[model samples]
Target: MNKAQVVEAVVLAKKAKQLTWESIASTLGMSTVWVTSACLGMNSMPEQAAEKLCELLELPSEAKSVLMEYPTKAWSPAIPQDPLIYRLYEVVGVYGDTLKEVIQEKFGDGIMSAIDFSMEVEKQPDPKGDRVVITMNGKFLPYKAW
Candidate 1:
């Protein structure tokens, strides 16, 4: 089966089993974000992890190998259409330069490495309104200059 089908099966199984990403990650002995991304086809899991996840989900045999295969990551829209996604796009449009400048100032001439990145999303309770908090940590890759 293709990665998309595998992801579909994973989602179905997750819902059917009422399993949290944290729980699955614990089973795989990995991070929640990485495990979730792997299941969603953005990253590849190791063979052992893939087998364990497939067994946990009771997925088709084809799913195990697919889950361990490297993925070619791409997004459909150049500019996102969904409201939440578009909001993130807008945030980049508005603060991209400021963020880049600050990051460079702090870290030197370097870029964040998505390949070695981790992200966490949390909900903060507030009296008037709850807040969505996102934290991203990544290795910094500096330019190789002569």
Candidate 2:
């Protein structure tokens, strides 16, 4: 199976089993975000983890191989149309400059490394409405003057 097929199989199996990403991550001894990203074909799964996931999902052996393959990590340049996705894009559009300035001030001239990053999503209870909290932790790579 290819990456897209593997992703489809995984999603279908997960839904059929009524399994949450957190549960799958717990079973695999990995973070929820990382596990979900791997399953969604955004990241490559390690050999053992791929085998475990395939076994858990009752997927074909081909899926395990596909899952272990590194992804191209490409996306469309067009603006997203989905409401939730568009909102995130909007946030970056509005605050990207401010974020760059603040981060540069604190961390100097460099960028965050998505290759060595982790993220978590949490829910915060409030009287009026629930709050969504997203925490992203990425290693800061400072520019080296050569």
Candidate 3:
């Protein structure tokens, strides 16, 4: 099936199961807006996100594998005008610089490449402040010349 059909199917199933977008988004560690846009076909699902969605929705193995296939193009030709992606962009616009600086400080001169990483999160309790600790491990591979 196509992306839109997959999205529509998931949304329909979610509604029938009385599931909330917040629940799904939190489970996926994504913003509700992003999940919503993906469900409505306004945004394409990245492979990782698509795999998570397939698992959450209890799709068949074939469908799950299909959803995880890499797309031919890096970016979709049809950019979303959805409020969700727009709001995400607004958040990036406002806080992206601060986030970048913090990330650089923590990781030194490189990025945490999503393609080569694993992430785990845990909740830690403290008297002063409760914290959600996220640990990401990635292979540190420098770019090489051909």
lDDT per residue as tens, model 3, 26-89: 8888877557656666555677777887788776555554455444434454645898767757
C-alpha-based local distance difference test score of model 1: 0.93
Comparing candidate 2 with candidate 3, which one achieves the higher TM-score? 2
For candidate 2, write residues 1-146 as lDDT tens digits: 78899999999999999999999999899999999999999999999999999899999989989999999999999999999999999999999999999999999999989999999999999999999999999999999997
Any runs in candidate 1 off by more than 4 Å, and if so which? none
User: lDDT for each of the candidates?
Assistant: 0.93, 0.95, 0.67
Off by over 4 Å in 3: 20-65, 71-85, 116-146
Q: In model 2, what is the error at residue 32, expressed in angstroms? A: 0.6
Model 3 is weakest, by summed lDDT over 10 consecutive residues, at 65-74
Error of 2 at 109 (Å): 0.5
Pairs that collide, model 3: none
Superior by lDDT: candidate 2 or candidate 3: 2
